[model samples]
Target: MDFYHESVLLKETIESLNIKEDGIYLDGTVGGGGHSSEILKKLGQKGLLIGLDQDIAAINKSQETLSQISDNYKLFKTNYENFEEVLDSLNIEKIDGFLLDLGVSSFQFDKGDRGFSYKVDAKLDMRMNQDSSFSAYDIVNGYSKEEISKILWDYADEKWANRIAEFIVNARKTKKITTTFELVEIIKNAIPASARRKKGHPAKKTFQALRIETNNEINILRNTLDRMIDRLRPQGRICVISFHSLEDRIVKDTFRYKFLDCICPKEAPVCVCDKEREINIITRKPITPSEEELKNNNRSHSAKLRVAEKI
Candidate 1:
């Protein structure tokens, strides 16, 4: 299947970057190269764009998409967490700007075979890197009920976490839950009919939770934010588009903490902790999709864009 993703917040993200003509830039989640393409358009011949993704499909698609625009970009099949190593290996010092659009891509969900969508009936295999040994199948079939429940609640904020976990444990006793549809069925059964009707899809949260656990999305984001900011040149920007509140909160808190001029205890009358502010938070509140964008792409509805500039 073709790797196609509707890049959310395209205009807002590009504008947020404040791209420089000859400065180096990076797209950490270069799915289908949507934002990367626009970034390239703003770059001069001396400018560089490094595109990174864990999915080989995204890398390949981005390579093709970007090559059509310019040969000035390089695509890497590595997780964004390893971006520092990539930059170091290339002898690159600091980037003028970088972007991370965090979450499952439209292609991943639409492919059906990738098993990211609750509406699909494919095998339980939500590995973003396909090369990864762990998968949704392993989590669903092998994890303890307690573990599953915790993942559902923490990652997805699913209210029926306990019930869903219990139902999954019980159903697996008869046979393994090996497919997306099977899990969807279990989720539907676990959620009361009245409760299910109150929300969008009954299986959406469970599927999201499983995908996050399978790919270690949250942990990667948590570990990489500071490093990513540190990699920016003075006055450089970092724009992140997060799909859900969990991801948004992490980005917000990380930026908030990093922007703090001091971490001293309130009781300290005089200055103590000399932590200097690293970056200025550009958006006190996140930028959401415009109504026009929401109408054009339904998947963009949940996206929130946050930006910060190195001090």
Candidate 2:
């Protein structure tokens, strides 16, 4: 399948970075190279754009797309969590700006074989990196009911998590839940008909939870934000576009904490902690897509872009 993903908040994200013609920039999740291509357009010959993605398909597709723009950029087939190592190997101590678009590419969901969508009937395999040993198959068939319940509740905030977990455990006892459709059936049966009718797809939250757990998305995002910010030069900005509430909250809290001058308790008379502020929050609120963008691309509906400048 061809790699296709509409860049969400494209103009807003690029503008937020305050791109310099000769500065170095990084696109941490360069899916389909949509955002990276736009960033490349603003750069001169001296400017550099470093692209990173875990999916080989994305890397290949991005190469095709970005090569059309310029050959000055470098592409890496690795997760953004390892971006620090990439920079170290390249002898790049600091970058002028960076952008992270946290949405999964449209190709992943639309390609039935990837098993990211509950609407698909393929084998349950939601590994973002096709090379990863762990997958949705392993999580669904191998994990304990309690573990599955926790993953659903914590990652997706699914209210019927316990019930869905119980149903999965029961169904797998007869035979392993090996396919997306089988899992969807279990989810539908687990959720009451009235409740299922009230919301969107009955299996949406469960599938999202499974995909997140399979990819370790949330934990990696949380761990890498600080490192990405640290690699920014003074006055350098980091723009992150997150798709869901969970991701948005993490970006917001991380930026808020970094922007704090002192984290000491209010009751403390003296500023003994003396925590130095590392960043200035550029977006007091996240930037959402325009109505026109939302109408043209349904995927941008949930996107929220937050920016912070290294202080």
* TM-score of every model versus the real structure: 0.98, 0.98
The digit string of per-residue lDDT tens for model 1 on 17-51 reads 99999989999999999999999999999999999
- Expressed as tens digits, the lDDT of each residue in 1-311 for candidate 2 is 79999999999998999999989999999999999999999999999999999999999999999999888899999999999988988899999998999999999998999999998799999988999999999998999999999999998899999999999999999998889999999999999999999958999999999999999999999999988998999999999999879899999999999989898899999898879999999999899999999999998988999999999
The 0-to-1 C-alpha lDDT of every candidate, in the order given, reads 0.93, 0.93
Clashes of each: 0, 0
Worst 10 residues of 2 by lDDT: 196-205
Q: What is the lDDT of residue 176 in candidate 1?
A: 93
- In model 1, which runs have C-alpha deviations exceeding 4 angstroms? none
Clash pairs for candidate 2? none
